[model samples]
Target: MTKQTEELKQQPGLILQPGPSGWWDSERVSSPCVLRCADGKWRMWYYGGDPHFDREINLPTGRCGLAISDDGVHWERVKGPLTMGAVFEPHSDPNRFDAAHVGVSDVTYNNGLYWLWYFGGDSSFTQVGNMRAKGLRMQPGCAVSADGWHWLRLEGPYRGALLPVGESGEFDELFCGFPKVVRDRDGSWKLYYHTLHPEKGFLVGLAVSEDGLHWEKAGQVLGPGSAERFDERGVGTRHVLPIGNQYVMFYEGVNNSGYHCIGIATSTDGEQWEKQDGDATGGSVFAHASSGSGRWDARAVGTPCVVPQSDGSWYMYYIGANEGGSDELTSQHQIGLAVSKGTDYGQWKRWGE
Candidate 1:
């Protein structure tokens, strides 16, 4: 057997299950954020809602919810939702840009304050009636908080839409959400986000910021069919962890089989990426189904958010689905977790590996 196989066989079985007291069992949770709070606890933020069985509603009104963990394994969601409605920026034309249902995706700490990057829009409703609704842009915005609880909207659309297909078309015409931001070793800020292209499907894009207020697209960091043989259909939201000098991106991939699976890619300079073979590819590192026999996430897994701890163990947060089908619009999804053995991003062996 290979080294990765040997590692997997030696580890204990760590399954991704709902939190205590059905904390996340009732609601569909997606886009998880894991952070070690200054208060010495693990905090998780995720979008929660009941899947809409009705076709009348264009999209689910996803609200942001908070959960806390002591050991980073057993979690308890804090009481009540954290943020809601159209979050306004500190110095924007409120009349022209503040109208939309807003939601937070990823949160990070900087200069002793918590900064949140999120997506806001009313496009789901507008898109249903007029195709021109494509003009609506789901862009990245920011908010800040002295304490982790209370927040204030700080900036809006630091970067414009993703790359516009044509001069006339909006860059992020379809949608762009699930943003993950991190400060590079050089002190520049990098944001990785999911962008939807009308014809190319959904993929991840990269943007850079100097002062954290303004941003510019670097280029397509991860795109569809770039590898041709590997990620043919598309790749979506990723949680990146900087290990040593390189960065490891754990992201979702949809193949020609129409099945969703998680995979890992490494970047030496944080721009160019090489897909890892064996466990890093599909079967070993990426699991198609959940651990449980009849669980909700038995069908597919995606939206991987990872946190590296001081203890040398890594925690990965991702979304799981019970529905056997591979449609993004489906509702049987929940947020889950997997643990890796070491701090090395390249040494990721799946839970129980």
Candidate 2:
């Protein structure tokens, strides 16, 4: 399932578009936090939705937003809600426990400060009335800031709870969230998240911390019946990059292809992982947006958030869909970019058009 080459041929690419009221009118920016601003400018902590919930709770209560760019490729959303208060009661709201949602986020910069590992949740109290309470029971939430714009929330529960469902009946006891933290050159600290195992639906879990907040759980780093195959229907690990020393995970593979595609795997010691590009019968490594023929990326590209560019080239930042219909309620998810020139994960390209 890899065929399309009308010959635009640039190769080393750049295609970030969604700031003109087209990424679903500007309200669904999932799991992205790429920062590099000492004065050079390039900050983005995304997860947005407000218009009540983008016009009366269409779902997705994610609530972290702030954008700025000098040259990371045109961005400018900075008005409010950068992890600001109230998200579940008495959770002590440092920034809040995902007031009802706040799924993926990874952003790093250690020691000096500027770490954010997110995954908060509350599905409107577990869909009390149904419809508006779809999934997600995530945990893992933390925030820190030197000047990433006044953030504080940092304390226990960096990842706890959510192993119920018969003590791990296979995931989905209602807890666990998409928190991805990585730092290991010698600094030590590795975390990759995503949970749910009432019967193992969404998996991708691992944890380790030296001083990030005391965590330990290097179990099940990609599930739904490992390698033998069966993605079952869930997989998550949104971002993890190291490149040279080898460590590149950019995941989100929900089976049957109703949508969600973007896979990649590789780890040297980040903790054993292999599947260099999409496997598990679902074809690994995916991203589409040529559309010269109309089904480039009909709707759904998964959540990937990569960044590495001094001039070496590598910018992935994913999430796509200009329309809708891959199910999961559908609202036309959005956010796109795909460029790979030398990290050698195999020359990816999808940017602009």
Candidate 3:
């Protein structure tokens, strides 16, 4: 049975936290890209940062680290050979697309090889009203790995990126970030990425690839929810899983009040998506812990990484923020887990619950 805490609900699936060595992930660890193989060993590739790391971007991102787990609950960090124990970092050249910072969004093992799809930004700074933000021109990039540690960059047209931002007067002209890829049944590929519109908030765009290197833009597919809905604000990092004959997308949505939660959407062709009505928290199948619960995820939860189990259950590894963190950007982000009740995708319980 799950243990209850006073009147506040607990986030029992809260397993991995930030590293304590004050190295790379001492301040915040987020964006979990977990892969569970046939041998039952779990490998999670996540991005994190320390306090003194990039003070200009406002988002907690710099380098990515790796963690290993036996049961997918308890995790042990691997001492990587990169800087500050990071498995991957930004490019060395200032003219590169990922020269500033990088974050892994998808890690797929196909035909005895691992394909890592990530998003990165340059050091160019842009002044938005009163604040100065760096690395706003984010773009998608790709890399391949044999041992999951050493990687070789598959350079794209836009300075090591698979796709570039949209042209003038386009929806994604602002930036293209957080790329997630899914292989279709016909051996073709679909790359899903997002961009922030000044008026429409955040919208998800698609691009199809034949060889997973060259891509063609497919326009926007998913956007913000209805008025006063959980995703009324916008959509963020998401994962698309092909289960059975249909495709399911677990995405992050931001409300009007800047609170983030995880929402569900279904599609038959993987291009046209329909948002399913969520639980009590508007359109979110999984919501953040109550604000007064004093939990690690009291403030917000987003960036879902869902994995299916053999017994029909599902595991969703996500990033959460506490009340102490300010507006999504300056928050102290951490990683946690949530489990669905049996095969009930709409109903979920934090791990241990």
Native-to-model Cα distance after best TM-score fit, residue 294 in candidate 2, in Å: 2.0
Off by over 4 Å in 3: 1-11, 327-329
Sort the predicted structures by lDDT, highest score first.
3, 1, 2
- When 1 and 2 are scored with TM-score, the better candidate is 1
Please provide, for model 2 over 82-145, each residue's C-alpha lDDT reduced to its tens digit, 9 standing for 90 to 100.
Answer: 2232221213333434555554377777678887676665433443334344334457767677
TM-score of 1: 0.76
Worst 10-residue lDDT window, candidate 1:
82-91
Write model 3 residue lDDT over 46-74, tens digit each, in one string.
99887777777776678998999998987
Winner on lDDT between 1 and 2 is: 1
Judging by TM-score, tell me the better candidate of 2 and 3.
Answer: 3
Clashing pairs in 3: 13-351
Model 2, residue 263: distance off in Å is 16
User: What's the CA error at residue 277 for candidate 3, in Å?
Assistant: 0.3
